[model samples]
Target chain A: MKPDAPVLQTSGLSIGYAGTALYEHLELKLFPGTLTCLLGLNGSGKSTLLRTLCRLQPALGGQIELLGKPLQRYSPQALAQTVGVVLTKKHYAGDLTAYDLVALGRHPHTGFFGSLRSSDRALIEQALEAVGMASASSHRLARLSDGERQKIMIAKAIAQQCPIIMLDEPTAFLDVISRIETLMLLRKLAREHQRAILLSTHDVEHAIRTVDTFWMLRRGCRPVCGTPEDLILGGAMASLFEKNGFTFDPLSEHRAIAEHARPVGIEGDPAIAVWVNNALIRTGRKPSPIAPSYPCINCMGKNRFTVGMPNGACKNVSSVSELLTLLHEAESMPAQPILPRYA
Target chain B: MRAGLYPILVVLMLLLFAACLVYGSVFIPFDAVIKILAGKAVERTAWQSIVLQSRLPQAATAVLAGSALAVSGLLLQTFFRNPLAGPSILGISDGANLGVAAVILLAGNPGQYFLGGYWAVIPAAFAGAGGVMALIIYFSAKVRNSVMLLIIGIMIGYLASSAISVLNYYATADRVHSYVMWGMGNFSSISLERLPLFAVCTVVGLAFSVMLIKPLNALLLGETYAANLGVNVRSVRMQILLCTGFLAAVTTAFCGPVSFIGLAVPHVARLLLGSSNHRQLLPVTLLAGACVALLCNLLMVVPGAGTVLPLNAVTPWVGAPIIIYVIASKKHIHYFNEA
Candidate 1:
């Protein structure tokens, strides 16, 4: 195989179960040293497509080439040496330490008994370090948190030493920090190790930030694949969630609900105004540049804010909490302004 | 820790084997038993005959039967991914029981059927068990869900049990009494003449189980992951069914449905080793099963009494508490490392 050849490629591929096609005639390629994210809603055939590529499920139609060889021609063991997978299903490791679990990834390379040699052990250790799970190597999987377990699973895949790695919803059950960390780790693994890494995730914001390529899957529509920028600029992201009452916002690279609250004007520093707008939107009040009749928040400076009410009563606040409190308190007052004697 | 535990378990098994030989309905001195085993002249001919004919075969049967059943149980549990799954859960034992029931109740003069010295019940049991296994294997292909396969197995067990009840209703009084005795189970039933056949079958089944350790370990992660790891999931599942079926069937044939050891010994091994890697777990389970069975056999031979207790009656006493403890302290037991 040429060094620059794609590690995984599918042409005119169809995927589904038992002759029922969820996707048809798909053309895709995963190159080495690149991270590709498959973005889709639930039941959008992302997992089905991944399963087909990994050969866990047979392709309903078309051809898949692994390292320029026909995928079907490779035996299961031979395929295993080339492609490693981290499934979404939680495993019953059963009192196995993180090290033991990761060592199992060397099974294809190890002999029939799966006895790990010194080199295999070194790979296991390196894999653990790659996922930042080296410290927890001795700990039983039961003792680890979900995120830690997920990282350990990824380490297992890394220890397999495959050029292509595929994961299904790897960050689904993780917290925000762990999710970002897992994605960042995959991105690094792809670039540094020059492995073709493909992961399916609902986290579009992170995918947009980290992935070199994107495969957008939508129900009843052919999957569209391109660079993240092309997809966003081509307005494909916006249409991706159009049927689900969600609009993809290019600026945030996140999907937003179509229904939004009425806007309230705010005059503030650009940085603070962004946060202020976020706070207002979270409270069901949209931030606008102008809403003269409604209460407008005027940012005096950092950490200082003044609410200018329609009735001419100006209230001083020091924090976002105080600002929200003043806003809520002002909501119950009469609409007519009570003119102050000094004013 | 597990490395240390293995030697301790092996020593314990040896000690129990010695106890099974020395302590029986007829108490033979330890030295005399050793002499008898060594093919030396013993003090008395009866003692020699008792040691060689009864206790020796009984001990050997206990070891093989116990190991076979335990390994069978382990295979089923891993295949189903349910800790509670056992050798009998898949209806193989019930199928054996149904076969025995047909012979003892439907066949006239059960004594005459056994008078030829070759037990027809053994072949009958093997056939019935094999039949159920074939049916299960057929269904296994049709039903991809493990839980559903488990339910189907349980329903098949129920069907076999109902058939056994019908046979019991028509059996003669004496035949029913003998059948009930057989159902209680006994390691002494395999005489010196039949021990060789029992040993060969059990050893082959166990060897097959040893070969399955890799795929069995993969199965711990569930079928999909196992497949991704290059395991031929369908072939492995079939192998497990075949091995478990043959082991459970042969053991049930020779020693009437030896209970508790099959269902409980794997848990004991898991607790002992604090791991479930089948490479270590399988050997430990086999040795532990032998130890537990020999212990039960020793307990059955009540001191100062000529009569021995039923094997099943004594088994639950040792087995039930372990199972109860396992169930009660499930959260504390790291049977599976789950997040």
Candidate 2:
């Protein structure tokens, strides 16, 4: 295979269960030294596509080429040597240590007895260190956090020495920090190792920042593939959630929920005003810059605030909660400032 | 630690084997037993027969049966990904029991069946166990879920056991008496003459298990991951079913559903080694099963009690507490929640 050729390429591929195609005639490519994120709504065939690509499930139609060879042609061992995958489903690895779990990635390379030779041991250690889990090599999976366990799983994939790696929802269960860390790790692995890495994830914001390519899957639509910026510029990300009655917002990297509310002007330090604006939006109110009127919140900074009422009365408050409460009372009282004044 | 534990387990198994041989219902002198085992002429001919024929075969049967059943249990537990899974859980042993019940109860005279010697039950037991295994393999392929396959196996076992109870109800009193005695399980049934056949079948089944260690370890990551690692998941599943079936069937055939050793020894092995990698787990389980079985055999003799307990009666005493501890211990919960 040419060095610049896609490590995993597909043309007119269809994937689904038992003759019914959830996706049909799809074109996809994963190039070396690039991280691709497969993004989709629930039941949009993300998992089915990954499973079919990994040969865990049979494709309904089309052809997949792994390293310039037809997927159906490679033996299971050869295929394993080329493609490494980390599934979303947790397995019975709790009793195994990080080293033991990662060593499992060397199955295709190991001999008949599956014993680790010195070279295999070195690779296992390198894989562990690559994932930054070298210190935790002796820790059993059960003792590790979910993110740590996921890192070990990636280390196992790395130890496989495969040119292409695919993960299904690798960050689905991790906290925000772990999600970012895992995505950063994937990008690092793709770049430093010059391997093609594809991961399916719901962490779109992080993926947008870290991944080089995006495959947007929508039901009843031809799968769209491009750079994350290209998809956003083309407005494909906005409509990706259209079928589910959601408008995807690229800026937020989530479904945009339109909130209708009365606008309240916030007069405060710009830094403090941003948080106050966020608090207002969360409470079904919009923050407006024009603040020279009643029904305005004065953010005096350091968590102290004053709410101006329509009745020309001002309520001093020490907290955002108190400010919002005074605003609530003024709004509920039909243009009358009914909030109790403190002496 | 596991490296040190392996030799200790081997030593323990050997000591238990010797103890089983030395302290049966009639205590045999250690020197006389050693001499007999060496094929030397002992002072009394009866001592020679007692050591070579009675105690030796019984001890050997315990070792073989223990290893076979324990490995079978390990395979089932790992295959199902359920720590609670064992030989008896799938009803393969009960199928063997049903087969034995059919041979003893349906045949006109139990004495005539015994005329072929203690080997008569082997064929029927194999058939019964093999039949259930075939059904399980078929369902395992059809049902995508392991727990569902496990439930179906249990239901099949219930059917076999219910059939046995019905057979017992219709049989004559003396025939039922003979069937019940067989149900109690005894290692002494495999005489010195028949030990070779039992040894061959058990060893072959265990060899198949040894070949499965790599795939078994791969499967610890579940079927999809194992497949990704180049394991032929379907073929491995079939191999596991066949190996566990052959081992469980052969041991149940000869030893009459020897309990607890199959279900509990793997857990003991895992706890001692602190790893489920199956590289060490399989062999350690084999040796530990032998040790436990031989120990149970020695426990049956009860030293100076002058009476031998039924094999099944002594097995639960050793097996049940280990299983209970495994279930109750928070440390091992990761092994259980897999299913």
Candidate 3:
């Protein structure tokens, strides 16, 4: 975390839809420069938590504060300047271009007439650049693909120049590559801009690999908050799955069932990614679409493919003696692709 | 004027105004018509009175009513965020109708209804308009969604119409006849004596509209986004409801429920501006509205005639096609940011 004030906090808060209570007695704080991934199963109050913090769906009990100011204490204009929200719902209703949409972030600072001042335009351009959307700056909101649209939305929030950016399931409609790219962009924002990027995403592996901290919510349980390593190492990841059938493999440090887990190996560098992918398929592993993002080598064929192992040794392998070492490295880095080997 | 909107509107309005000045229910030569306007000697007393008194007021009334209705329609469309929403849906004008109904039917007996004197028409209209405005404001406060409010407004209009029907059913034949004439809708109903009051009310409503131009732009972004931008959403909605009600009520009181312009002109204006910026939208709405109403009024002259189309019939023909065009075109203009 960047030594800054907390960007989002809930003090013993209860949240709900208009008249119905969904969750209560919740307290949390997210500091600047920390990418917090909020997770929960459906109906576990994930969206409810976000809405309360955003102060859109008002809290029925306790208070939510941003930057130490009670959420309601800040005027709408003041709050807009301090906090930018990207809801998963709306893209844009108006026939505005990408520049127009991003420039809307400056709406808080711009006069009621809402003109584009030079500084405002420059900041808008900068935000687009930050989101890697500079090339698409002139695109209309309706004309872009889902991932591009999400980036544009974040670009708009950045244009507001708020310290805290809260997004609710921003990757919901994006394709896998777009989702990972968006997550990477968010991490970049947190690391480089020192802005808090708190987002709720259904992409669990992506979140685990990219975000600094986790806010995990399960039905009938208090939200579990901790660093990703703590949550994974402390056997918290096992509880996230079914206890009877699904189990965490300590040797591999991955979430899987012991009965179905299998080993398949190939030789040579750069073939590891494809070897593991084909092996997982051979073993009837579901092969979640996101498992192959990292490049890997196969010892037998000396070919490369992007395939990070779920629970296996993967690194440089001169001989089968180094198989365990590669698995440990793969688990530790999570981003590393598991290489094919024989020990 | 970029699309030649302002110029087209000005030239069209000027030519129509001139036509109204020259041709009328009574035939007058072009030379005499030009001479009368130039303050030269004219031969005919009746022609002078018809041209100077009847046609001039009528033309002025068409311009005023048309502009007011167009701007009001534009405001309501933006406020409700619905293509179908319009000023008449609120029944505010119908509320004025009921008020005028009461004055015409139940106020006194037959010919003596005018016994309230020439002063009665303007005050009665203002009161009726004020009454409807109050009702719409109250309903607006109760409803949260603009779409819901629009539906409720339609229901209110039906209720007002029913009430007017009941009043007509019970009134004497003479009162019924006069009320029916009133409902036909007229451009020359505002006499020279009553011009100042009508002018004052319309100007005040239009001025209020100008003040609202800023908030109206924010509102086009949708409610939550607008609130995020520090717009007092509830208060803005209330103010809009009041403005719509007031404008509709005033125009209705004087023009006898002038329809179509309130609903279609805004869509036309939006097409003209090609953007949602209210700064441009509001003026375009005003000019287009004035042109439409004045042209429709000019249609009444029919080259050498005074028999105008019933305002409601002509308005639907003019208003419906524009509305259809907007909807058909809407499918083509993609909403880019709908994530």
Candidate 4:
């Protein structure tokens, strides 16, 4: 095996339960010092693929190689030392403190009795510190919040000292802040530890910012894999959620749009214009500076704005809240017949 | 908290054991019992005989059976990841009951047909329990879902109970009466002659449980996490099944299906320790189980006017309240948080 070979590789792989396949004849590779994000709609086989890669579930057909060897050839214990995993399900550790839970990662390295050596303890402490969970090391898992629990689980994987780590929807249950923190932590681990980290997430926007590579799985299609920029520019993400009126906007990093969004023109200072555009977009109105025959907004100051109707009737507002409320009411009103002069 | 509680549990267990030894129908004074235990000749010969032959074995049986049943409950609860799981819940004890029913009802005079002695019933119970355990293990392999496997166990238990009920309906009056007494459960059934075998089996089961501390702790994180940690989930599960089956079977065969100890004691240990790390929980559970069982044995003879309560009848009074506490405060209880 070449030293520069990807940390994980799969060729012509098929994944699913029983004889049925959710995906087939796939090729993928994850390299060291890179974070890869797998994005897909629910039930698109992201988890199944991860399970197959880790050898937790049998692949329907194909080859999975870890560290440049066939996955099946490594013993379960050997595979554990090669690849660590954080599953989507919540772990129940009974009354174990955060420290005790992380120490369990030493199972593959510890003695038969699972006694931790001094070196093992130091690694566990270091892993906890890496995830910023050192303060909660003695805290019971039950007492910690979902974000804290996730960090602790990551710390456990780190303590395992594997070359590759896989997580299934690690950010699924966390708040926005935690979601960003977790993705950022994964990116840091990949770069600093020189480990290959692969995670599946629904938080595609955040993932796009932190991941080195993106693997997109869409229903009934071959998985598309590339750098974040390649997938975005190549329109792979747009096709991912294309059925639900969702489009991936590269400039804004927004992956989905509402089906009934209306276009609104805005002219203002660039700084205030960005905020106004964000406000309009959030309210299901597409803000653009160049659209004619549509209602337009002109931001004259930080807290003042004018709404110009297609009929040339203008309403002035002093606050964003009032502006939004006026826009909402106007949009809800039925359109009046256009006069000959306005037309 | 667990470290402090260990010495307390040891003292409590010893006190309960002494209580069981001294307070029986023929009450010997505590000092006299101690003297008798030390192999000294007492003034009354009958007191020595009662203390030596009956109370000594009864107390020993309670300790062994209690610890064995508690350990079995802990293993099953962890394996199923269900707090309500126990030896009885999995139908192993019911299987033993069916075995005894078969021997006493289908065969003529349980003592006359096979081995011509009381010893025949034990092997029959072991076979029944072992057979049902094998069936459950087979189903477990086929059914990947733990909840589904648990439901299968409950259904298997119901089938065994139904079979036993049919046997009860057709058996002779005297045989039915004896069977009813056995079903009520008794710690005194194992005479001094049979205590050695009982001790051996219980000890072996408990020892095996100790060896599984690491895997049990791993499983506390769930099967996926355990497997990720290099635990062979299939083999560990099978080992747990075997240990639980053997312990529950041996205790049921000798003691006529002692109740609640197997179901309730592990929770009591967790409550006491405030943690479920099996290294501490298992030993504390063993001690707490012995204490609870010994206390129940003492309660059985509380009336003292030549009337004794059935072990099963007395067990629920102690076990039910603890279970209720667990349920009532389940949200506040850290141990039940995952469940």
What is the fnat value (0 to 1) for candidate 2? 0.68
Question: Tens-digit lDDT track for model 4 on A1-343?
Answer: 5545798888999999997899999999999999999989988889998898898899999998888799999987898899999987865674788998899898889877788899999999999999999998988888898899999999999999999999999998899999999999999999999999999998888888889999999879999999888887888877887887855556543636565678788888778877887887788877755555778999889988988977788999998889889888777766765546577
List the lowest-lDDT window of 10 residues for candidate 2 chain B: B108-117
Ranking by DockQ: 1, 2, 4, 3
Scoring only chain A, what TM-score does candidate 3 earn? Answer: 0.75
Arranged by lDDT with the best first, the candidates are: 4, 2, 1, 3
Point out the higher-scoring one by DockQ: 1 or 3: 1
Query: Per-model C-alpha lDDT, please?
Result: 0.85, 0.87, 0.72, 0.87
Model 3 TM-score, 2 decimals: 0.81
For each candidate, give its TM-score against the true structure: 0.93, 0.91, 0.81, 0.94
Model 4 DockQ reads 0.54
Best DockQ among the predictions, by candidate number: 1
> What ranges in model 3 sit over 4 Å off?
A1-3, A17-21, A91-94, A132-140, A241-343, B1-15, B30-35, B38-41, B45-47, B108-146, B333-339
Query: After superposition, which runs of candidate 2 have C-alpha atoms over 4 Å from their true positions?
Result: A242-255, A259-274, A285-343, B115-119, B337-339
Q: State which docking tier applies to candidate 3.
A: acceptable
Model 1 Cα lDDT, one tens digit per residue, A1-343: 6767898888999999996899889899999999999988889989999999999889999999999999999998888889999988977785788888898888778777777789999999999999998999889888888889899989989999999999999999899999999999999999999999999999887888889999999988888889999998998988888887656556432535344555567886877877787787678675656566778888868789988876766788899988888888777665455445325
- Cα error, residue B139 of model 3, in Å, equals 5.6
lDDT of 3 by residue, B1-339 (tens): 247776776787788778767766667899988887777778887777777778778888887888888778777877877777777766767777878888888874466443353356546766766776676678777876777877877787788789889999998899998777667677877766666777788788888898787677666567766766567777887788778777777777777888788888877776665655676678878888888888777665545454656677677788889878777776565531233
How far is B70's C-alpha from truth in model 3 (Å)? 1.7
Q: What is the per-residue lDDT of model 3 for residues A49-114, given as tens digits with 9 covering 90 to 100?
A: 876777666889998888777888988889888878887766234555677678778878888677
Candidate 1 share of real interface contacts:
0.69
lDDT, candidate 1, residue B13?
86
